[model samples]
Target chain A: MIGTLILVVCCLLSTERLIIHAPRPGRLRTPDLITLRSDQRFAQLKAVLPTTGVLGYVEAPGTVNAAHYYLAQYALAPLVVDYSPQHALVVGNFFADSPPDLSPNLLLIKDFGDGVLLLANKDVR
Target chain B: MAVALAAFLCFASGFALVSLFSSGTVPDASAVLFNLTLSAGFGLGIFSLAFFLARIFAISNIIAVDAAVLVCLIAALLLARNASASTNLLMFSPGADEQWPRWLRRILVAATSLALCGALYAAIMQALAHPQGGGWDAFAIWNLHARFLFLAGSHWRDGFSSLIPWSHPDYPLLVPAAIANFWTFIGHDDPHVPAAVGLLLTFAAVGLLFSSLSMLRGRVAAMLASLTLLATPFFIEQGTWQYADIPLAFFFLATIALLAVSDEQSLARGSSSSGFLALAGITAGFAGWTKNEGVLFVCGIILARQIVFLRAGRKRSEINPSFHRHSSAFLLGCAPVILLIIYCKHRLAPPGDLFTSPASMLHRLLEPFRFEIVVKAFLRRFFSFGGWLGIPGTVLLLAFYFIVGRGQRRGLPAGHRASILALFLTFIGYFCVYLITPYDLFWHLRFSLDRLFLQLWPSTVFLFFLLITPQKLPLSSNVSR
Candidate 1:
């Protein structure tokens, strides 16, 4: 019985080492974000986004923007978060390093700088 | 400090509730632990109740939580003054029965302390590392829902909107509601609150494990049982993560613990209102309030108890009179929470992930290949859960059982046996869920089977230690076993 317990203790100490120190500069523990804070790019728009109602959401076509859409939705919750730019107003999130080129119909509503763009949907019903 | 004080108020209210509904069979042990475990369990139940009321009245705020909890505390304090505590556990306590060598006792005590402090430290550091959450589910589902409830004001229902189908809006709201209530009390959202809730439940589960065993089984059994649970890596991590599984597990173990306490109290008095059974049923019902699987546990425990009662009937029909009373007491405690859950499912939430169509479920059930995959995955995950360093805790428990022998001590009571059966039935319910899942069988099993296994892991250790332990164990005289 003592041997068994000693073994259990040893296992606990060793396994905990990997768990505690696994996340390093070059090593990613898992793909999920470590924190839920919004980027400063959204600092302006997040405050100005409509307080309620469906908010159409659009972002640059890439894996990173898709992830950002999730973040934007989280930031602007209680409002209906949709992936298409079909609502009366749409949030145009673009990469801070490379902003998206505009289409003909997405009229600029506001540019909450650092890559956060808001557009009024001309094609809205 | 404010969070700690609020938690204390919550614990006081829970202790008062326990006193009101108690059978006076509380065992002699660490008063702090006993109070903390019961308080955490009772606190969650009360918080959920208050949150539910707030939603109904559109008044979920710090004032509402403070008003509700303070009222409960005051009323309980006034009423519980007349309540009595039991000393029957004194007979089984250390030094009262068998005196172990001081050296051996020290070793056991040290081991318990080490496991606890180590787990607590690791859990805090892990939570500190992930300020957002421990995993994807925290921010995506639980905390996200809390954000809606906390920040959206009257529009909190938007968190349950169908637009976010993957968020499992249909899931019960105990963890989120409790967190949101805490956030509301502090007047804003803070990641520390969820991290702390996780901490409270994790250690509370530990406290329950240790205190319950010490009361019923003996001090050694309590220490060993708690040590095993504390040693589990995943239980600690999941407890730190802002997830519902650990909350569900807490309620699950509370149900089993309360049943044992009720049984012990009833036997002591010869016949009494099994208020503990009622509380156990309520805890199980609140389990449903924690997650979808908890609903299954509520039904499973009730059915398991009934089956055991009926089985006991053929041998002793005279006990049938008390059986009905106990059953009714349980239902009375459980029905209100079950009603709340039913309301949530029907009124506030969307459909669940599984069984979207009766036809698809029927098709899935008949496929032998899916069955094989799920069964295989269950077998594999069962052995490696909680990131255990070596053999899984379950396997270690089984080995211990084999070594100790499976004989039911002649002194073991019927009610205790009944509770064990209910736990087994809950496991069976989990197995059946795997068989009829709507998702790809292997993928579903691999991703979730470990966590699902963890839900029962603590209870399994508790029951295993309870059964294998002698009806009367003598303290070891030797320093080394």
Candidate 2:
């Protein structure tokens, strides 16, 4: 009787947890919006982005989504992600509500909304 | 269409290699499932090997890889076509030995089915929640490395540059290589691929536990064991999290399953063939190839087995159960992957972050504080690691064995006991790593301890079920392909 109860309780609780998080089966065909949005957000900027060299990535130091740096790097691979905002072309992921203060020499080339900004460093070597 | 053909070729190559190495020729559900799982792993091995060679030769196209894989597949299939019939055939008959009441059996089955349904839902939900995976390590490390491999073409080496030390490029490439192989076939990276792979490994681990145990133990034991694994919330989540932990768990379970079968065969036959032991060794070697921790498991398992034999005080003898023969056969199986791992560590990859600076490591090891933290963490996670929902699964499982007490034999064979001791040894090995780690000790433990426990959890369940199982085997059951 105790064995049955243990199994029953475990089965029910695990199932409940899964059901709460389970997405509609239909939505599976739709790839994650993270990738989709990243692609859409970077679609036009890809042309101006360097075809063969390292791309720079800069973000506010303590934002929750430091992951956007890696995702942007992933979506636009073949280009190295240099986290230091030292390169001529740097991806400024201002994931917070407002953009971060930066060197005046750096100019905003594109704003892919929702705080995804592309900044070009004017002080290029 | 081309991708379909490539996948088929990959499966064929793996299937052929497994069929060749397999001890049991009879095609039972468990045997077929185990063989298919092995094939998938071996197929990935073939792809990684060819891709690694392709890089050295400055060749990085789909056509070159497809041709090589096809040739290898066909050759392996043809050469091993006439391999002899299995000396032992394993069949699944739920109540072959003793009879449980019909209502009891039905209840057990219903409970197992519900647990399985729960597991499936969790895995699906996880995949849907983050098609790219939810954890920091997924996108940041594994998938990121795969992007480097697939998108960077010949310049894949750029990913291992010393600049991005956080990526841990020195880590073995099994998970990344498998994902990259699938992407190369499809012609572009897909976020769904990792999700799918994660789910596959997750379910595959359960399948492996069920099938192997059912054949070796019985249906009741198998169901309860698999249910324990399936009901673990973290196991399901980590499976879809696109981390190496689940994959490493699969390989660990495979090693234990193979070794258990080999031990069973040796007990049954006066002299067992080395086929199963060889396969166990190979699986152990694959474990080493999967993660750095796997290398420790391989060594720990072997060391534990030797220690058991040494303590037994057996005289040296030329016989079927001779410790020397079995150990040597196991080593023979591990040789190929061991070589590949050595080459990868010495030649292709960057220095591993852990244990890189000996002076600092020595300093850290000498510090008495590190040992206290790790021990406390180990004990904390030990009770909590099952990832159960309401109550911890481990607590319930312990209640299970205690209530089910002595209804059947629960003691283990010498070999199975060695496997259990090896697991404990591996835990000790993990402790040693925690002691010497270069990273901030708490941070490393916070992120990784649960997973390290998870890697051994399934195998622990397998062992627990093995002991509690009724050990009477019925001879000459009808076989099904």
Candidate 3:
């Protein structure tokens, strides 16, 4: 019994050691950040966000161009953005849009190059 | 003929080296050589088998078994020299019994040979009946890359045309590129090589799983697991179709083997268990390299390992060093393929209309809770076994579950429980992903659920046998006698 147990242990130990010592093939190292095209930026943003977070970005041409829908499905956060700078179009799903309308504490942040971003807390206006 | 000769040499050399060094006090030079040779045989045997079968069946335009054989040889040398103790589960079996009945002892050897022959035959038939364009995903994604590699030549790197962000580009090119390289060598582009290669690898995955389980648990458990996977309707179907699921299954089985080794080592003093843990990490990383779903699987494993470690009451300081090392090793193994996937999505492929913008996330979050769709899709995937051999297998799964749940088997190890938990978590993760998908959930479920189930089938069946099979089974007696 002890012999069988020792054999099993040795085999397991040796295999494990082999895996750790083995040189990994085809491993790539990338910088923390890479510059993305406007559309690619949107894809990156969608890829990074949590499933429940809402993303509200304007859909104007050359502004916030959404590219990969499948990637965005996992990025299912609500987005409320003004597509055209001329129009204050607060477009988003019911939950995100409703919270701003219902609360006095919410405030619209300054417009970035593409569109206005929103900031809100229940305690602050 | 040369290809067959090369494969024979690889196997013979590997077996001889293993036999030569298996009993030595220090497993340094000979052990390393044995591992390298065996891995080479394992990889090349599968690769050549795919190509040889493809050529015989006339499914592919290209025929360069020699190139694949060469690649296998190179890979073997590389793996042997750079080999780690962690991934050595390939060699981790109970000591062989020379005194056992020849018939009983030879069953696995025979089964393995038969399975390889069957895979080779299937590859030939698949090659002969090769489709003009690529099959669905082959044409849509995997083969498209192969097409670009062959046609674009030096500019093949420029073929990252798909805008599907999630459909990773820079993924490992070991399988697909190997196929394309063969095609290039033979002066003809043939996607069937890779497709068939995928099938043969799946067979290897099944074979390894069977052989390992048979050695560790018992013959019955191993046979059940292997036969169940082979007979799985969806598994067999997907084996024919060139998909990433089988490879992922291979990685999954690899992870289980590593864990099993680690567990066995834990019970024995002077054993190095961390090495298996590290190998498990590497295999898990490869699983991620195979597909986007693999990333989620990695997350699941990390979480599972954390849970197991904490439950074992290992101190944070002691555990942290080992955990960090394993994680780094895993990342080192996985990083290249992951980077390629990222590069493909960000730089190469055209962006699609899927969730590219922040607003898309909102739309998708609500999509899964579409009650009617979720229920219908779940039901279809869970119950529908019409085309595949799922009906009988599903019945067996249920029976196994029920029988095992009754606690017929005693002394189940903690590692076994952890693995079962990990499997459950994986199933839930996949299930939730399907639920949340923005597309036609029902159709997606019908298409993929069975294949998804195949990923866990081998492990599940093995666990089932472990629980239900009587301790005094006849096989054990036969072996002892």
Q: Which candidate comes out best when scored by lDDT?
A: 2
In the range B246-302, model 1's lDDT, one tens digit per residue, is: 888998888888776566545554455566777777788889888898988888788
How much is B30 displaced in model 3, in angstroms?
19
Model 2 lDDT per residue over B346-424, tens place: 8778888887999988888889999999999998887787656667777776777787745755445667878999999
Against the true structure, what is model 2's DockQ?
0.45
Most accurate candidate by DockQ: 2
Candidate 2 — which residues are off by over 4 angstroms? Answer: A1-9, A21-32, A49-53, A60-65, A86-89, A95-101, A104-125, B63-67, B81-97, B313-319, B405-411, B474-481
- Fnat: each model in turn: 0.17, 0.47, 0.00
lDDT of 2: 0.75
Whole-model alpha-carbon lDDT for candidate 1: 0.72
lDDT scores of the candidates, listed in order: 0.72, 0.75, 0.47
Candidate 1 similarity to native, TM-score = 0.89
Among all windows of 10 consecutive residues in model 1 chain B, the one with the lowest summed lDDT is B472-481
Q: Can you list each candidate's DockQ?
A: 0.33, 0.45, 0.01
List model 3 lDDT by residue over A15-97, tens digit each: 23323322233221321111112224344343433322223333222323333222122122222122222222222222122
Stretches of candidate 1 off by over 4 Å are A1-33, A39-41, A64-67, A102-105, B1-5, B23-27, B60-62, B80-103, B317-321, B405-412, B472-481
Q: How well is candidate 3 docked (DockQ)?
A: 0.01
Clashing pairs in 2: none
How displaced is residue B218 in candidate 2, in Å?
0.8
